[model samples]
Target: MNWLLVVVGGMTGAPLRYLTDRAVQSRHDSVFPWGTFAVNITGCLILGALTGAALAGATGSHLQLLLGTGLCGALTTYSTFSYETLRLAETGARFYALANVAASVAAGLGAAFLGVMLARAVWG
Candidate 1:
C-alpha cells in the first residue's frame, strides 16, 4: 500500500536525518545550523531526482510515495531551518542568518536542478 510505503520510508528517513544531523553538527563549531541545511539540500536533491525519474518513466507511484513523499518529507525540516535563521538573527549573527537564507535557497535550487539533470541523464 502507498501508506505503508510512506510509513516505512519515514521510519528510515527520520532516524537517518537525526543521525546525519548529529554527525554533521558534531564536526562543526558554529550556530549556523549546518546539519539542518545539509539535510534540507540533500532532501531537495533526492526529491528532484525522484521527480525526474518519474518523469522519465523510470519510477512509479509506489517509489514516489516511499522516497519522495515519505523519505524526503521526513528528512527535510523547514521549521528547523526557519528557527535557526531566526535564532541567528536574534543572537546578533545577522550576517550568518541572511547568508543562510540566501545560500540555502540558491544552493537548494541548484542542487535540485543538478539532481534532475543527473536523473535524466541516467534514466532517460
Candidate 2:
C-alpha cells in the first residue's frame, strides 16, 4: 500500500514537474533555470507543509511516503540545478550561476519555513 501510494505520487509528480518546467521556461527568456528553481522551491514548500502536518498529528506515514518521498522526490531536481549552475559557469554566465545558487537556497528555505508555519497554524 505504501509503495503503491509512492508510485502513484511519483507518476503524478514526474509529469507535473516536466510540464511545469516547460511552462515556466517558456515564459522566461534567460540563462537562469527558472523552471528548476520554481519546482524545487515549490517542492520544498509542499514537503515542509506535510512535515508540519505530521508534527501536528494531522498526517501519517502514508501521506509522508506519497507526497514527501515520492512527489517531492520526483518534483525537485537537484541534478538539474547542479547541471544548470555548471552550464552557466562554463558558458560565462558565472554571475547567474552564483545568483542561482544563492537565490534558490534562500528562497527554497524561506518557502519551506513559511509553509511549515502556515501548516502548523492551520493544522495544529
Candidate 3:
C-alpha cells in the first residue's frame, strides 16, 4: 500500500513537475532553469504546509500519509537534483551544478517560508 501510494504519487508528481518546468521555461528565457526551481520550491512549500496541518491536528494520519508521504515524497526530487548536479559536474558544467544547488536551496527555503506564512494567515 505504501509502495502503491508512492508510485501513484510519483506518476502524478513527475509529470506535473515536467509540465510546470516546460511551461515556465517556455514562458521565459531559457537562460536559467526557472521551471525546475519553481517546482522544487513549490514542493517544499506544500511539504511544509502538510507538516503544519498535520501537527495542528487539522488533518488525520491517513491524509498525511497521502499528502506528505505520498504526494510530497514524490514532489520533492532530491535524487533528480543530485543526479543533475552530478551530471553537470561530470560534463564540465560546474557552474550549472552550483547554480542548481543554490537555486534549489534558496527557492525551496523561500517557498517553505511563504507556505508557513500563508498557513498562519489562513489557518491561524
Q: Which run of 10 residues does model 2 get worst, by summed lDDT? A: 4-13
> Compared with the true structure, what per-residue lDDT tens digits does model 1 show for residues 10-76?
9989998999999999999998899999999999899889888989999999999999988998999
lDDT of each: 0.93, 0.94, 0.75
For model 2, residues 1-124, the per-residue Cα lDDT tens digits are 8999899889988999999999999999898999999999999999989989999999999999999999998999999999999999999999999999999999999989988998999998
Q: Please list the residue runs of candidate 1 whose C-alpha ends up more than 4 Å from where it truly belongs after superposition.
A: none
Residues 4-88 of candidate 3 have per-residue lDDT tens digits of 7667777777778788878888998544556766777888899778666666667776666776677777666777677777877
The candidate with the higher lDDT, 1 or 2, is 2
Q: Candidate 3 at 19: error in angstroms? A: 2.5
- For candidate 2, what is the lDDT? 0.94
**Which order, best to worst by lDDT?**
2, 1, 3
What alpha-carbon RMSD in Å does predicted model 1 have with respect to the real structure?
0.7
Error of 1 at 19 (Å): 0.7
Clashing pairs in 1: none
Worst 10 residues of 3 by lDDT: 29-38
